[model samples]
Target chain A: MSGGTTTRVDARGGSLFAGSASVRALVYVALAALLFGFGAIAPTHLASEFVLRIGAGGLLLGMLALSVAFLMSQAGLVVLGAASVYGGVGYLFAIAMSKWDLSPTAALLFAFCTVIAYAAVLGALIVRTNPLAFMMLTLAAGEMISHSVMLEGLRDYTSGADGLVVTFKGAVFGMTAADFANATQFWPIAWSAAWILGFAAFAVRRSRFGAILRAIQENEERMRFSGFGTYLPRLAAFVFVNAIADVCGLLHVLNSGFVSPESLGLSVSTNALVAALVGGVANSTGPIAGGVLFAFAQDQFGAHGFTQLLTGLAVVVFIVLLPRGVIGGLIEGARRRSVLSSKRRRTA
Target chain B: MRAHGVIALLIANSLALASLLIMLSSGLALIYGLRDVINFGHGALYMLGAYLGYSIALIGGFWTALVVSPLLLALLGIAFEYLVLRPLRGRSHIEVALVTLGLGIILGQALIFVYGGEARGVDAPPALAGSVRMFGLSYPLYRIFLIAMGLGSCTALALWLRFSTSGLYVRAVSQDPSVARMMGVNADRLSLLVTSLSAAFAGVAGVLAGPYLSVDPGMDVTMIVNCLIIVVIGGTGSIAGAIIAALLFGFVQVAGSVFLPDLAALAPYVLLFVVLLIAPRGIGRGRAPA
Candidate 1:
């Protein structure tokens, strides 16, 4: 339990690199290389298109999962309403771009600003409440927003649950103009965004704010006593992390070619939570792995409803048996044995 | 306009709402107050009860299901306690909450797989099938029967908890399980009993509800959300609180829909938010069965 001993053991067992920034940067490079390699070698046929579509979808879900995992693992915030933030911002982006003829860049900027506004206002109100209260409030907020959108009055804006489709012919930094013309064309942008976000999250976890958040999670009262503004750090983290979720939503709409009320539904929120928990909320990579697994299972079991049942079972099993999540549990176990052997050596 | 007709409709609706609310909130209140575990699976249990009733009514008779379904569900509740909740006894309440949430999802999806995700219904028995005239207005006799059954069950439960030795132990365990155990009361047994009783109540509610509402996979989500709102507003763990909260919510829901159908869905949350702002602990906090 000594901090030094734990750190030494973690270092020795490769736990440091297991979810570390450098490792994730390497993962990003590897994924991009693999995708490019596959695109290069695959026969120009329908099968490659299918593979690319699924891969892109997996990457989008992974990005969403990564945002949630960062908040849950790094900050100990179980945000059941994370998907609403994602879907809400996406909806806003689509409406702004398609209905009002706002430029895609303006829409994306508006969506991010809206998410920050939402997080600050709602986070400040519910941040002091207990976890259950916060969760219920978030659920209520999500329901209210969805219902509002679905109402006849807002139908013109939200399309009243029928959903809205937007055409994106914009370029980011002129990196191949209008590349999102098709799913295959859109893959590079989505993957690059995921890589950049994942890298930034990894960097954040190493920063002073991350340390303070960890301290607050461990002993908030003590940290408050030491003159730190606990609430502000948590609110900032909430805003920051949810902004990333909004970006995922933006990419999701751009890649999927449409958005629907189902995206903001309770099931979607529950799915995000499940993915984050199953993948190991203790690290960013866990969600990436978890997201891909979840999306694949979803497609495979879509016909029979087996995927939902399996996901629920996995969540229960992971929580009950693997309390620290898959990766965290393995790393912790290795660290523990290493500490034990080192102690035995010192005793001898 | 006929005053008597208006009065009759109001009475009938009030009675129906009260009956439904009591049935839904009792078990929720018990598990929450006693075990400090919010059984998110309560809704699934409710759905199970309805499905059980539907099948029994279809095969044997409606009355047979009215009797058999609750008993079966009570046993299921006991099994749930021993299997899932017991093992996770000392974990954080939130962890238990999440696990039960997972269990709810599994149970709900499994029910869908078994029942084919279609809506099912049960017919009221012959005696309770038709409407009865009261104060110059006709009201469904089945609704009246439901009201009577709900009231009778509440009375029986209240009496048992007040007069029985085991009732005292349940109350003690709810207040502080460790102290109750120190005093030689079997906390685990009492927990199982309460959980079973709660599930049984939900089953009875399901049987009554099946005729009024469509029995479908979606029912679990709707019932759980409504019941959680009631339990949270009325007070967590207090049977009296549950009854009061449920009645209040039932009236608001029914009346709100009658007045403004469009805004009806938002009524409960609006009420919940107002109450939370004024009294976050709910209306009957300190009055929980402790």
Candidate 2:
């Protein structure tokens, strides 16, 4: 009776890895190829500088989205403040580089450490709360960061609302000569970082720690009953994902050579959420797909009439019609078709 | 710093703060507690109410606008529920919240496009324009009237929620939609009604706030962030919780501004952090059912 009940619950709960292996593999490869192609050609695109900008922008947004995706898709934590980590790291880098006159390498290191500390502290505090409260707390934390940046006394260090601008150090990996010669030298670094992070995420998703996180996502109480330290894992996931966002923040400051309040604003946070949702929260490559599509749509419709109207309409439509997200919806449809076809053959 | 003057200032400020917080936070709490939606667009609705009131008052007097704007906003809320929110039900609450955030951005920018982004304030009606002598100090009579209106509305809302069958149905559905449905309550219809009513309350607050606060496109961001903090500090599903939290926030804000003006802006967040530390479930005993 116990075994049967477990199977019944498992069936009703739905497995994350329900789709066929071949389709999943194809989806992953297609995503990898698209990222490579986009990164390669973006800097050269002349119809507008938008493609290249968004390619780089998507990387920054993707990093943040990935952080939230980890919490939402893996650990079942809905973090509304992932953008705070992104913005906080960027703020740290800007303050270090511009205000303190630190070297780029030193600034990057300081920023990463600060974000990790912030995430760990906040994660430990809010991890035990319900999802609703957790979401609100993260939002409050994000607002605090934004407001603190706006405070007048911090103007000397933070530049107040005027923001901070820092000069780039040209190159860090012995690619100075090549970077100066070619305009797209930074593309390789950004693209390589994307691939490495993506691979790391995939591996993590397949690991024992990842399995524990997934189990927690599926049923936190059950995992707790099984003697797992739920709070520690959730906190670890929060810090790890936020650390990834911090890396993106470092890259953003490096690429743009400037940091502004907009980098950490609510819009940046919302865009990351939108991108993750558009990509498919459940799938490993969903954020990549969502990031690309959001960037593309942002570029395409932004130049025309009303950008907010277009984007808002798209979000509303997607939420209503494509709740599983673009990639997830496609995967689901294909799976259903395959199942129906196989059943027909058996009946015949 | 004269004794009577200080007392008057304190009374006026406290009253003003109480009125504003109660008006804003009540709508937020009702929407979240009843509908299970954070309603990120609550501020947009508030802003829309102000603008609509401005236009209507310009043509049809202040009292008329005060009455009509909320009714119109209620219709808009009904339309919003039927159009945007109803379909998105049963999905991730985060997505629903994001969609509303998107709607807010769109509505904000749209308002800017339609009515230039300049800040506007309504002129108080001739009858309530002058000051009333209070505790040997002059205080704006219009503000006192606003306080009365706000408190009256809050009392009416509380009584309705406690006494009426529809209100009981809203409470029941909010507690457990499936159980409420089994108990013969139409959960979807209750959600729609509560959502519209909550938005209508937001509209009333906006109209009351228009004379004292400037209305502009940028106001939505500030307003929404403040309301969200208010709701978070208050428990999500309790009107009494909202009242207590709002009063505390109002006092902290007013007192902080008077004493520590520079840190005054940070007071709400400090309060929020403290509340999170003390009661992660919010201040009141209202617990949203899982």
Best by DockQ: 2
lDDT value, residue B25 of candidate 2: 73
Candidate 1's DockQ: 0.35
Top candidate on lDDT is 1
**Poorly placed runs, candidate 2 (over 4 Å):** A1-50, A168-183, A334-348, B3-11, B174-182
Cα-based lDDT at residue B4, candidate 2: 70
Chain A TM-score (model 1): 0.82
Candidate 1 pairs with clashing backbones: none
lDDT of 2 by residue, B128-208 (tens): 899999767788988899879867878987888889998888777666767888999987787778778877877887787
Q: What is the lDDT of residue B122 in candidate 2?
A: 91
lDDT of 1 by residue, A1-348 (tens): 586765565555654456766787898789878975564335234446666676667677777778777877666666766768878887888888878888778877888788789878777765665555555566666766666667765778888869887665565445322355466677666667766787788888889999998998778889999999998988888778887888888777766667788888767777777777767777766776677677777877776758678767877887888877766677788878877776665556
